[model samples]
Target chain A: MSEFEALDFYLMDELLSDEQRLIRDTVRQFVTEKCLPIIEEHQAAGTFPTDLIGPVAELGMLGANLPEEYGCAGLESSTYGIMMQELERGDSGLRSFVSVQGALCMYPIFEFGSEEQRREWLPRMASGEVIGCFGLTEPDAGSDPGAMRTTAVKDGDDWIINGVKMWITNGTMAKIAIIWAQTDDGIRGFVVPTDLPGFQAIEVKGKYSLRASDTAELVLEDVCVPGDALLPKSGGLRSPLMCLNQARYGIAWGGIGAAQACFDEALRYAKARITFGKPVAQTQLVQELLTEIASEITKAQTLCWRLGELKDAGRARPEQISMAKRNNIEMARNTARRCREILGGNGILDEYQAFRHMVNLESVYTYEGTHQIHTLIVGNALTGLPAFG
Target chain B: MRIAVCMKAVVDSQARIELDGDGNLRQDQLRFEVNEYDLYAVEEAIRLAESDEGHVTVISAGTADAVQGLRKGLAMGAADAIHVDCDPDDLDASGVAAVLAAALHDGGYDLVLAGVESDDLGGSQVGVLLAEALGYASTTLVVGTNEPVDGAMQVRRELEGGEHANVQVQFPAVLTIQSGINEPRYPSLKGIMAAKRKDLAVKGLADLGFDGAPARRVESLGLTIPPPRELARMLEGGAEETAAELVRILREEEKAL
Candidate 1:
């Protein structure tokens, strides 16, 4: 693949600070040198690239937006968003790994876990020495996490957790699982060590989308953990939903990366591919497809930059995040499809990335509070009416 | 051990180069990075100075904006940096060497390292000129170096035609590093955060006891891109005719008979 020409139609690069651009370029180089070369083989084999964990950790990518006191990079939220943009520009699987590790796993521990817990796990997780998976979505609960049946009951000084978390990224590789389960008071989070006797992680096979990522089913049969395992600050379903908001923010920017990747590949291919005695790029229909993809990417990029700004100011609402997630992901899904069309038959081949990103965007569209769920969340915010009922 | 690595800030290799109407490089859109070859010198200096009581300082003479390049060296584990504030374009290779030599003369450095040549100008003169000014022995195209023993170091110099010569040099020697001498590491996040706190002292021409004008022994006339060559012509017709045509073209047009 050719080097990605950043499709910044709006010249958004000028708005970023020097440090932010430096971090973004660093990650872009890392993905190009380390990830892009081997991702296709891993994607074809349906295996995650485990070797990248060290390099990623060495870059302080895991929990990068968290505080430096906890061994994170302590970067601005916009920088974190840009990092996700560059990571997903290579592949969604690579972005998913960082998202789960940083936003979902490390965020909760920093926000809800006790200082002891944070002291115990955050540093190791930041170094990639200890991998973690967030267990919130259940087999029965997809859009509605409140409907989850997983429960953590008090037994003496310990808590016994029993439930099955489905479609958990980094599940099989995690040494600790941030399992959210129902308690007598409400839904609370437990930093459950995977080595507990009744806990088991089974790799979910046959996944066509996100093939380069690990998805597993985590089964807990009376998994017992000490009292310190429970995140005392966690109150209800709102706690896990907050972590989703963080991850969703990153995915909002990530959507732009995937779309840009497809656009770059498609545009390059169209310029070189000849049809009807001229390059396909000269055709009116091909130009229209390219225009549509570029326009959508620009809109999504501007939206993500604004969202990142709002998040850094701490004024961002969940509904605002919902809007970005819903809009950008849908835009990416459409962009990937159009880019794939422009590639013609070669799009299906592994040598090309459009089809791969197109398939991966399908999974992205469904996860992190599905496209429909975010639609209702935005709709409810606008109309002042509950539509989920 | 105290070591100094001479680094230069050049235009990023991947960025498009555009010249102005005055035949000078358009500076507005250019992004500057540490010169590619200097990264090897910086890496080697850092590796050799890993023990306690060992320090590596990166020094560069360029415009104030070159601080970004110096900061990169700091992020790569340099203890500190010295930036000679001036436009590099205003100085030729001799002038450039004078500025660096003035900055490093009394710094008590045991070893001074630099790249064999810069990417943009390819002068390949700064290292030797700097050594002459500082009154130190100099060698170029250094591929490998062993630890200092009894105040002298053994180094392998790349020779022409796949040969290398090992030589011994005393303390305070200058070595112009080759690119493949070592692989430069990307700045870790920890190193980057720590770089903000590291010392990067800026020196004016007067601070180095000069009257703000370096000795410009050479000047650039102009720069132009060479004309593009004609596209290759394919021979027509089958074996015998094309062979005869190739011979005729080579003998008559190309004058290679």
Candidate 2:
């Protein structure tokens, strides 16, 4: 009961199937029992809970929404969204780990890899036997991935890959990496094993946000891979962008989870902590903060739910995902800040989750396409004009 | 071995309980989950079945919401489930026991497991009454159960004053599991999906050939929160003066000196 209970103001459960509800409840219980208890310590120590990988895989969460042929759960997209929401309710770091493994790494292999590659990796990755990471962003290219300096040269039947992928989630722990690079044919993806020569993933330290997650800078110098390493279906940058869209959809749901956590903490603290002869929750100013956050969370829930439906129907566009990610993350950031203020001095401590979520929201807001980049994407869709130079 | 676990869906103990004008719980504002003790029983049953290469069947007697608990049990690897469609408000502990006993009498189960008590009512009578109704040997407050030996099971029972007694019961027995017997596993995603496809048989009280009326019914009088404690008075003076005043108060007022 010390953990935050999810707030469902609009009876959104009515929109979900029974299986989806069961999945959500299952993940919610897992988060409450497993993740909530150890998150603060892990976050403080700046170490991922590596022991959780086995249990998490047992939950069928790694590639839950993918096809069952790949040893996934074969759940609907909305169920996956709910899983992400519950994971983020525990910590953004946990959700980020799942998003990287499922959407960024496994998704490309499922969507663009050859049948042989999928056969070789998907089941193992799904079972947590082999961890995977996605490499797209470089030190110079954060928003503009098309301008990445990473290059791959064809050498007989093998390809020599040379690149430095920055801010890579699961980088240090990944057994294999899905590296997006520029090739003579065009931008392409290569599944390079992390044990290859000249492949080094150095952990990034001194992070104030997402501290429990493993983020690293991947250096690949003269890393060689066979012809089959190249994803056969990857044509251009759109392939990787599609994977980002998948991850961003999960982030959209995850932002709401963080916001809910913040709001729950602030509400609980407001009712319990007394000031001026009464609970702070009774005051109008504090009430305003709670109401605003509650309202925004409800709105974000509706948007994410609709987007999930669209995704399941295969009608959702990247622009739509951009809008949800941009809006919900901003909502989460603002709500986290307000909740921190409502918690007074206690909010600054790691004992309370508001500050942790507030700081983590900053990282979430910046990564997976920043607020400005999403705004431009929406703007281009709205005005029917490419705004990016 | 086919083990049967009896579960119930109860209001979440963590939620603030509010009483209605008629002295009944406010159902609209409350959330429900599988009773805590029942979850332990379900876990123990699943463990027994898994180790013995047997099957588990979870059964619950409650309103429509009880299906949630049954599905949760199924998602935790129960082979199937049965729900006795009866409202808890309409039945006493004996009535529920009768219904469940009737269902399990013909269930062909080797063993029956239930919680020592429910979270809402805290009535520790259902499992024992169920054993009597089904004409089965039963034990309550069972902390642990050893593997089946020659169709008999050895169980460790928690007695008063922190004592434990080991007892052996033959097959077709009942055990009311105590909490903390085992840590229940969360339902895996595949299990959740599988639960959706599993057969959950819903039967009415009459289908079990048991009357819906309770042998004894208890009505709630009212519910109220206990009065808050009085604030402690701070002695605002030097340590010596405060000690002197505190001694005086304890001796003259509190009478503790």
Candidate 3:
């Protein structure tokens, strides 16, 4: 509630160029007032917040982290992270929708699509008229996307795609999908509409994590994409990997939001919950748990602040991101465990949200390259030997 | 219309306030800032300037340290600034108004804007006396504003019990903007650097043909701390019990709600 207090810990905002704090605060207020109030109910109901799309667009969070000429907010990378942090502070699933819409969809198009491609799609995405999802992970080749068997063939003016993508966020509701397939050129990303023939998205149904988001299986069978729909500059596995990097940067900061929430809920509960005629907050064990939670939160916040700096300065590397994403989410998961113990019987119940975080991190822990995969990536960087097979 | 604004340098709201020997807030060592309410007025003047493409000069009468406050106005897009080194202790609403009016008398400005009150001082008589002394139409504590038209400005002034009055003033006018009139924008980083090169005219009391300042000593400064008293018993009970205890204590001892 007090931005001035947050500024003291994460002065990441101070490193911005101009008008960045204003943009950060505007999105912060929106999250605090609008998102936080109804997020729990929506998350519990396991439904995507469709009403949020227009407001998110109005705040320029839809197609943020892009050039201004293409109807984007064109904010600095730190500003984008601040927006993601505020949005995820409400719910990670809600912020994930924007990440998919902006970074996963608009970014590859703006970076690789021809001029006509930019004109046709960016403005609509900016205005929230269109929602999109990325199709890259398969039922088998999630962590190692290069092993995917999806294929696209050149046929006249159209390209035929045949593939299946699993665990696609916003898959069921999206109007378009940035589908990555093995083409003759190499592994490439494509813009495929949901309305195309032989393209279908089936709701994955009971999901233990990110339930509020529309997780689905995106299936393509001879789905004809116009030749121009193929991303012009995106070739090899690096193109789709770059999109993952953008999403991971947001996720790196988002983990702190989840950790902070768990810590705050447990802190409040510990102060109020009484056992043996004394507040649990006064117990040495509970205090120790809280102290650990606070330290991790503060350190992760400091790390992410620098991470945002590296991103804004154009020096952010995948291995550098591998460290934060792996460290912070595990830290968050541990904090969630401490919170669950503090709440005792109340923790498992829906009223406390500690268990939800614990379960959510299990999926978040594995998605966007599994935690072990990231550890290996970092280890490989340290030893100067690629350990990942 | 060319307009001038006079602002005060107060300590930042978030800064911890301590009572000085004078039994007032000790401002030393704290980051001094422009009054929060005045920020909305500055933003309004900027809005006027943007639409009308007119000149706005901000003036503040304090020591050289107060130039920081004036530079804040410049960074908010003021045309220029003026800082007059008037002693903070010697200032009253009317006397400061006289100093300001003397500084801007021949500037050919059509309007003047100021905050209704400063957080440090409860008095809100400056804009009225400034307009009166300069023979300009005056309105105080404006809560809302309408688009400028026909060489006049229309403002909504609060009355007793949540009532409001729509008042219009001709070209030469003064209006004290109420707090929460608008949200002031953060000065762009570029604006702060740009403000450093902006010309800030500093004038002395003699420069205005003013022999000296007006009357003071309405209040005297003293150095004594209040004696500490024993702590009251804080009730720790259910909401209903706490509410009943509060009501009983209010009725029996305070004798008024």
- For lDDT, the strongest prediction is 2
lDDT of 1 by residue, A97-133 (tens): 9999999999999999889989999999999999999
**lDDT of candidate 2 over B1-257, digit per residue (tens):** 98999999999877878878777778777878889898899999999998979999999998888988998899999999999998877777888898898888888888899999999889899999999999889999999999999989999999999899999998889999998889988888988887988989998888887665555566657666667899889999999999999999999999998
Candidate 1 second chain TM = 0.89
Rank list by TM-score: 2, 1, 3
Instruction: Order the candidates by lDDT, highest first.
Output: 2, 1, 3
Better of 2 and 3 by lDDT: 2
lDDT of 2 by residue, A134-236 (tens): 9999999999999999999999999999989999999999999999999998999999999999999999999999998999999999999999999999989
For candidate 2, report its TM-score: 0.94
**Model 3 Cα lDDT, one tens digit per residue, A113-177:** 88998999998998888889999999889778999999999999899999899999999988999
Decide which is better by DockQ, 1 or 3.
Answer: 1
Q: What are the clashing pairs of model 3?
A: none
The chain A TM-scores for the candidates, taken one by one, are 0.99, 0.99, 0.94
Cα misplacement distance, residue B61 of candidate 3 (Å): 9.0
Worst 10 residues of 1 chain A by lDDT: A16-25
Interface RMSD for each of the candidates = 1.7, 1.3, 7.2
What is candidate 3's lDDT per residue for B169-228, written digit by digit as tens?
A: 897999999887787765533354456668899898878777787776455564355689
